[model samples]
Target chain A: MIINVRELLPFLIPLIIFQLLLMISALTMIVKQRRFKYLNRVAWIIIVVVFNIVGPVLYFVMERK
Target chain B: MNQISALFKKEAVESIRNFKLFLLLAVFIIIGIISPLTAYLMPDIMAMVMKDAGIKFELPVVTAVDSYVQFFGNMNQLGLPILVIVTGSILTNEFSRNTLINLLTKGLKRHNVMLVKFLYTILMWTVVYVFGAVTAYLYTIYYWENELENILAAFGLTWLYGIFLISVIMMASAIFRTSFLGVLFTVLGVVIIMIIASIYPMTAEYLPQYLLTSNMSLLTGETGMSDVMPAVLITAGASILIFLLSIVTFNKAVM
Candidate 1:
């Protein structure tokens, strides 16, 4: 039942990097924007940071004005 | 021609500034990467869980086909909806914001607008789809040595289905004023087609939804090209017809 971390690092790294880049971009935009369409800044930041890949996507698609 | 290119440039610039392009590419590439990795890890993960329950079952050897199976599944379930939701507002945004009004007033042909949007959607879909497919292919090959059957037809049919979906979205956006409604309509339309296909299996050959559902069989060679040709032709024809209908409706539409 033991899984080796080294065995998974290569596969995990790229996935994590892609997600991090998306989250960071979404966070940067959320911080810079003065207003959003539906939610306030703090709510959006939580959504973007907490929801992994989908939250930031929702922000970019729906909230970012 | 010049107007089309000009409008295309505008679309490109707008998508870039708004991060649509970046988001699409990143999300799809993630899907691409995750698909192969999941296929590769499936057996080990299963073993880890089964070890606790004293269930010993022999798992089949995973191959490149398994990777593609995951790829197609993720693409259909995750990739397509994201594609629809992300680009759903392409035209509705213009309408709601009245951005198209200035262009129409400045002699931009209504048909040209529809055509450019259609082309832009196809271009973006193609780029991201190919990138995702290629990434999955590379990773799948790197993990498994087995070769896939009907690889080109499988991928190409899915790509065509995506184009068909894009046309449906464009038509929906033309009819609905809000991005949310357009996405809802397109998703409902797809579901309706799938429901019909399931209820009347005889009509499955003609439904575009068949393309998405039959891809796994096609990959495994259980579904032949002849079996898929009818749906392919119907989807291509329907895409063109629906696009034309969108333009006709868009022309008569009150801006």
Candidate 2:
């Protein structure tokens, strides 16, 4: 079965959105818990903010205390 | 022996209590089986849909490679994330929850904790992966038998990718106290490696991503086994190094 790359594009946007939502929620959790003690907070914050919504979410999850 | 056995026992028992791992397993199983099946059915399904318009062409049926390709694709793109999800917090949970701190104070060696959790998660990935591969293989064999040059090589690539993924998960889990962070780090690492690999095809064989796709060319005899040896070596080496480093990092990482 051959899958054209074109057909796959339709799925990626939503996957990205879901990822962003997941990131936002994760960051919210860390923020809510008030746990921030790391040497990489700026790098972490930039990753979250730059990657768009998911960037921060992913960073928050990574930065969790 | 005690650490290995007790860790396994604890992890097994914990697996029973936690639905998170089970849920991830279920999702993985679905992706593993369905992605190939969908790819296999695509031609026929598309033909059927287009049949009404008389837009017909010879429908190419699916093969074992197709299923394997599906397996690899799903495993790399989606399955890795699931492993990250399960492993991201396996060790950290206890620390974050104030559960492991008491246990560690009682007498657990930091290395023992890392090793146990690492082994357990490896075992978990192996079990689920074997189950998924076996199911897909049986179904593939049932439907098509041609062009299966090396069943082992194709599927082996998928598992090898898992080895790399689990290693990343272990390290990421250690680096981050939370699961999301662990997964993010692992994903970021993978993407970075992939980007670097794109620039250097020579390094392609060593990339974990290649462990999933390179075997297809090898099986079809399009590339020599030598094409994949470097990847196998790199993935194995990286996995071992990461596991060890994760232990060191975990030993120092505060819960």
Candidate 3:
């Protein structure tokens, strides 16, 4: 499958940047906060990096105790 | 008056310090950007995917109305839930952290605490809604130059619905012991209102939920000011009434 990255760059760029910003912010908080409600730091790091859009948001809403 | 302002300022500063304000604004702004972007690019994306599968389909021409519909739909589905999740634990978490007791012991009136939280949360809602709406408006106009009818009223009605939701969630948070329970009760309240509105469609104009579902219709001129004014007024009234109930509940709460 030949996907044209150049063709979609205009539309995909903003979304990618936003996703990165959210992830970085979540990761910084996860690293700084030493509290855990359900999962530990390693588990949350995995979740945040693995889930992409939902991972960071889940951390922010549920795991940020 | 001084006490109220002091409390309000305290809440506002707390919200900022905790990054709730920044997080929510970012979420809403992203939603705002994605709505119109998706509406604009969906046809091409679909075409590309279909071509890969050896299928052919024609998509209808997208317009400003489509953009606004997408924006409102995203706000209703994801944005509202985010609002509930963020503020659903406002009072319950305070109770859990023992801050409520600390403030009360310091001679802060319970009602003032409740009122301050309510005012700040609603103020945040208003600002966030405006941010999303303005971004969507600018992108839609730039992409598709068309005039919409009753634009202000459409935005106003949606904002009112948001206020109504925050009121219900605040009351639920005050009544429930755990933040999770508070969120559950608020979701249940919304579901019940939806069921009742569906059963009595004729009275939808009197139901606060009507404003949320019919926002797009208002922009397209299918719904008029007369059709929306009733729901707007009802939502405003219900927000105030439920807010009062939340205050009473907070006062009687055993914190």
**Could you say which candidate leads in DockQ?**
1
Query: What does DockQ come to for candidate 2?
Result: 0.04
CAPRI quality level assigned to candidate 3 from its DockQ score: acceptable
After superposition on all C-alphas, the RMSD of every candidate to the true structure, in Å, is: 1.5, 9.1, 2.5
For residues B1-255, could you state the per-residue lDDT of candidate 2 as single tens digits? Answer: 776688779888887555444444554555555655666676767877877788867777666677777767777776776666556677667755777787788787888878888777788888877776776666566666665676677677777777777777777777775555655666577767686776777766567777666767866778776778887888889889988998888888766
Q: Share of real interface contacts recovered by each model?
A: 0.59, 0.00, 0.21
- Model 3 misplaced stretches (Cα beyond 4 Å): A1-13, B48-58
- Estimate the TM-score of every prediction: 0.95, 0.72, 0.90
Q: Interface Cα RMSD per model, in Å?
A: 1.5, 8.5, 3.4
**lDDT by residue for model 3 (B1-255), tens:** 777999888878877876677667877877888898888877777888888899976778989988888888898887887877776676677777786687688888988888888889999989988998888888888879899999988888878888888888877877785666755676667758675866676876688778888888989989789987877887899889999998898888887
Candidate 3 matches the true fold with a TM-score of 0.90
List, residue by residue over A1-65, the lDDT tens digit for candidate 1. Answer: 56678876767898999999999999888889886779799999899889998898899988753
TM-score of chain A of 2: 0.42
Q: Which ten residues in a row have the lowest lDDT in candidate 3 chain A?
A: A1-10
What's the chain B TM-score of candidate 2?
A: 0.87
* Residue B127 alpha-carbon offset, candidate 2, angstroms: 0.6
lDDT of 2 by residue, A1-65 (tens): 35665654433444345455555654454455445655355555566566653354244334542
